[model samples]
Target: VGAGGETAHLAYNSGASTQHSPLEDENDYEESDAGSAIGQLVNGTNVLAIHGLNAGATSSDFHIEPQLIITTRTGGGGQTGYFATATPGAPNGRPETLRLPQTVTFSRSPGPFTGSFQLSITGAAAGQQIRYVMASPGGPFNADVPAPTLTSTLYTGPVTVNSSRLIRAAVFNPSNGQGGEPSTAQYLLLETGSGNNTSSFTSPLPIAVIDQHGGGGYGPGEPYKTSFLHFFNRGPGDIARLNAIPDVFTRISHKVRGSSSAHFPKRAYGMKTRNDQGENKKFELGGLAKANNWVWYNPWKYDDAYVRNAFMFQLSRDMGHWASRNQPAEMFLNVNGGKLDSNDYWGIYVLTEKIESGKDRLDIESIGSSDIAGDNLTGGYILKIDRADEDETAWQTPTAQAGSEDRIVVVEPEQEDEKPEQIAYIKNYIAGFETAVLADRAGNWATRNYQKYIDVPSWIDVHMLNSFALNPDSFRLSSYFHKDRNQKLKAGPIWDFDRGLNADVDSGAQYDPRQWNGTHFDMSWWKQVWRDPEFIQGWVDRWWELRGGALSDANLNQIITTMGD
Candidate 1:
């Protein structure tokens, strides 16, 4: 629902267009009289949501080709272009609406409001048309209002909206538009902190203020205490005071995240938010869906080149592995409603998905008390090789038990009463695998190769990932390995890459590109595996394959450049 509508007559181009326009052709092509008809849509401001409907009769015909175009008002000259397109949803249980990227924020005009926004569509067939809806400042969709025109409005100086509004556009066939069928609505807010001083409260980053009500700062060994987390989404427009504060703070468990970096000035955090009944539940932060837990990563030691951790994870996911999905944000801290008027500027931080067992994450069977055998007892364990804190159980490897310096820690199923048996099973299994690996007899080694216990390719990829960046801490420290009762021991959901890319240490001759840090203490198992010719050939093959693909120089440079910007 909107006040007006302006049709941004779009041309269906055969290929990519240089300018940022709603009229720009989309990738979804319909074979037409002229080869293919590419449909596209662009938001004038904050694009809340998009749903594509099929023009054919059957409901199965629903497919919307969607896109986003963000324009930054550059002085008085005009707007600069930045656009992101939507990829197809997952094959199973797909989402109805395409989720747009979170970091994309509009610029604020020098006025009483934020920038004006519009919606446009292209590739409209006779039966197929798009409906655009808008919600008033901090309000729901006004069904009474007509679909607004998405005209390209140029202002005298800059364009702005007087209030925060939610705008959603839906494309559907004429027949499906009957009975006012519920359409997916996208919520867009006009944030007003765009031109403010770059500080704690006014900075353009999303603000997460935790008022622990006089509780001391989160640190290792700290218990999950009561705290109120007030999150503020800072776009270019002023923040809308819309929701009730009491209804906002979900009960959450909080603690300092990293072991080695826990002593650092700017600390990272781990959070677990619970439901109203104090049971485990899922929530969203910064566009992430169904996330009950999150990790706030601090990149202070990187000296502003904070992209290493995020980029490393991106590489992992790109290389067809599951890694934490991260979004960059400026963080602020305000404890117990302190003397500070607003949140204190922490620095640039990464709001990341926590590695855990869940449907949206590593789908694994949970451990049970009664089940001592079968797949139930054999699976769903998350183990790590990391620093052991007091009161936490740490299992020494066979090597460590035999006077070598290797240790494995149980990360999940951490309860004292529930984890002992499960930990024993995995630790023993690994011990046996190591025995097979370290045996002097070649026949014993052949029968008990490490490949029998673990996912060899996963380990190989982990090795490549760490080696490419010369990550010294690779498998030795902050290294995670998990097994789903029936599944083989997998090497990751890799965590803690901030120390890689030469960020934590000096850029000297020690970080020689010609030589790799594969000889680290953690690689004792890997060193044994190297003795196997098959393992060596597979390792070499996987390394070069990734180097030519996700880990290539050009691919890496592109990622680095994007993060630097």
Candidate 2:
């Protein structure tokens, strides 16, 4: 467990062991250029890049691949192949330069509901074992201590890789734990022998990297860069119920030594009646006052915002993208380091309803910034990982993509060509930007009554929701990100004020529409929450699950825990 299957984006650890164990100690110090490699495809991949460089030596010693950090593996046998790097001081280093490949991507596995990818080492014969593992930033990691042993000694055939959305794969030689070359060479993936249809064709997954907007040159990279740091740093905060503080922090955080800081509040977000209490101030996390009062989102407890954002983090983790929730923090020396970006906003948390009706699951969409109603929860955003470092925003409207004005979060059609349209409608609905399309869907839902299924559709329609889009069950997660409707009295799942502050109408002032009729995130959101039981239940159950002991003492002591993870 020496830092294997972990991140290196952590701040300099005050308690890092002086002992240099290959598996534990050394692995913790590696790093990568995964963040830069994100290109236009996955701008939120900044976190992955930050981590790749941090895990240097251990990546080579134990062959422990950093889960989600970007490091592609490709070889011609007997020789290592080249990959992008981020090593500081090296040529093309510190963000993306030529380096060695440490991990392997999985080929798309073809399954009915779910899928998988397989790997193997090259030129290896049957019965010869090779160790491999797979993990995702959005998910968990799994390693093969007992490397896969090839039963067939002969080539049998070519190799095929499967590309699934669940996670990425990596292959390495484990030496059978016996420390000797086996009778034959082993392939890194299973597609060559018995797995593929004929082991002759190589079919990669038609991968789709979607909606990670904070960095894609389309949206703000500030908050997203901060999010990347915390996601990898905080690890996963698991929550179960309401009135309970969510443990937003996790084992992934790293604390800096001796950094004294001050507090200054500029503006208030995600609360009732936005205010500029000067309550938002900058202070060293180490010196911040402890929460004498119980926090609703304890670092130990996980909630829907936690889970939804967790999924987005995993996506960026695998893709080696960079993103964070807060502004990048600096040491007391006036020198900023470790993870975190500016304005303390990570990537937005996407919340989709799992509409189940007699064993059927439907699709719906929402964001970390949406307003919520119901009982346990009122109107406010959830699972937001604002960077404690940066405290400013340069907000603006979403890029003009087609269908940016639809408001009916619809279940993504199970057909091709229909996807873009479906997603467009959802984004508008989630943002509470419009309700025309939504009203069109369930037939004048403003005063409708529900007789079947659940209230998800109704809730969305009733509340002025907001989001980019929705899609699901497709080869990629984007298929699950668009809009759809459900049954409910008032629309909700609303919270988050960053998008409305001063730039646009929606976030600036809830009722005033100065710029072409804008949207607001405050009272307008809660106006519906007072009548919805469904909204209350979601928060109630979540807070109920994050009780005692599920949390560790180490987790409870910090203002943030991601830098160390």
Candidate 3:
């Protein structure tokens, strides 16, 4: 497809020379800063679909999902080595020729994407090599967005970049598919890093951003865990700004875990600190995070199909992949509307090294689910949490059932038939969803309570995997095969991790499918090691900011009822 190409060029120092990209599509999005609106993709879902032929015409792209089109043509049966040919507009894939540009650059998200965001010069001959660079704000950004180059005319501004998302596309043209100064001006969304607003994706940050607290992580007494950019590697300490709307919305998603985390808190307790405004104090609210609420990524582990999105989610969350790191100041409502702070609205802001070792956890808090609710600006639902336990025999099940307050275990009620596309709809909701990175667990780390022989903090286990969402696995890995926090057995803390859905049937080592990817909730260790409190939770309260005050039970009920029969 005359679109994107390879991904993940994380080295900030290696300085690979400019390269070229011919993409299948140059998909750039303008995300809504309010509750989820129509037209925009959510929950990492794709917004583009392969357009089909007219009623009279009989073409394949119109009949099936675009992903299937790529599969049939590329992998097993019909392998057409072409660019953007199989995109929505064409089934047998349309063939187009356009004017070529002199210089080009094709950057991409660190992990994965649906279409190629490649910037390129069309009409170049087969041999001509257009110089381009596929840059990312984050080192791990190798998402599905293919590579391409920017137009020479637009490459006028000075390419300024110190951290991730600070990008510029410099490409030298060689061969065009056809040759000569072809037709068509360079696409706008996929253009060079020009103009004050032309910065597309975020780039990677320096390594030091992770250990701001001397490798202690964020938060007081809890070690490190309060940097808002823990997920993307930038924060107030680094970017020195925040976008009130986007920042709070993303943070809310991280806290709610997912749409399914909606429900009355079994109990709510203070975290020992207060918001700068002193309105929204820190606290741990307990409830179920429906099954399938895997939010955090298990990076470096690509074998599990369900967890394939681990790296993708990590990159996607950073939001700065191909954008300008120098952002303007902005403000929005906080729980304490009277008081507010400045913010940078670029994209996801991940911290470094702090949560890299996600395997650490404790008995109080098992591998916390990322069942993060989507930013509300787009009319999204509540939690779509990962399941922690299910389908266990009397002997095989863990001695403890899921819940914080009442150990009142209720066998899961038989679920009625689901409405059409319910799973797909819910899945779609989270794919484009971006979470926040705020909050710091004050009082003390889980170790504080455990060592002091204090009562189990209610926040320790607030999510409900069995009753709320569906677990793709036969049972919850964290529930049973669990151990204690000894011999360096770190107790886990909760963060904005997500579910573990495998890639589609068409997505493989080569041939790919899907418009967007789901959030990465899979853990680093598949063998139930994320229960460490110091490791996980320490980062949770701080990574993403919260959207609304608390997860409302009314919203949860409304969401459940939305699953029409």
TM-score of 2: 0.20
Runs off by more than 4 Å, candidate 1: 1-200, 234-248, 339-343, 401-406, 417-419, 440-448, 504-522, 561-565
Q: Model 1 over residues 1-565: C-alpha lDDT tens digits?
A: 1211223442232222222223345563432231121223343333344322223344343334533433435588532222212345733222222221221122321111223444333333454444445444212222122332222121112223333333333333344331112122222222335443222234444556544433446776675554445555544473422221211345466778677677788988877776433457677776665787888888876535777778888899889987877766655453432232323456677888988887777677766666567668787888777777665677777466222454677766765645556767887888877776677235634564556788888888887788777776777787888888788888887888776776646555346766453464246566666667677689888878878888788998888887765
Error of 3 at 364 (Å): 25
Q: Clash number for every model? A: 22, 175, 203
Which residue segments of model 3 deviate by more than 4 Å? 1-80, 88-90, 93-165, 168-565
lDDT of 2 by residue, 15-63 (tens): 2223344555544755433455345464333232322223344434333
lDDT of 3 at 548: 23
RMSD of 2: 30.0
lDDT of 3 by residue, 1-565 (tens): 1112223352323321333333345443212232233335365435543222222333223222233122123555532333422255643432223333433323322211222344333322345544333333222321111233434333333343222231223333333332122121111121223332212333333211111111121121221122111122235545422211122111111121112322212111111112321223322211111121112212212222322222322222232111101111111112111111111122221211211111221112221123222321111111211242232111111222222221211111101322223324333322211110000123333233232221122222222221122222212332222112212112222222223334222235223345233111332121121244553563355233211212235433443353221
Worst 10 residues of 3 by lDDT: 432-441
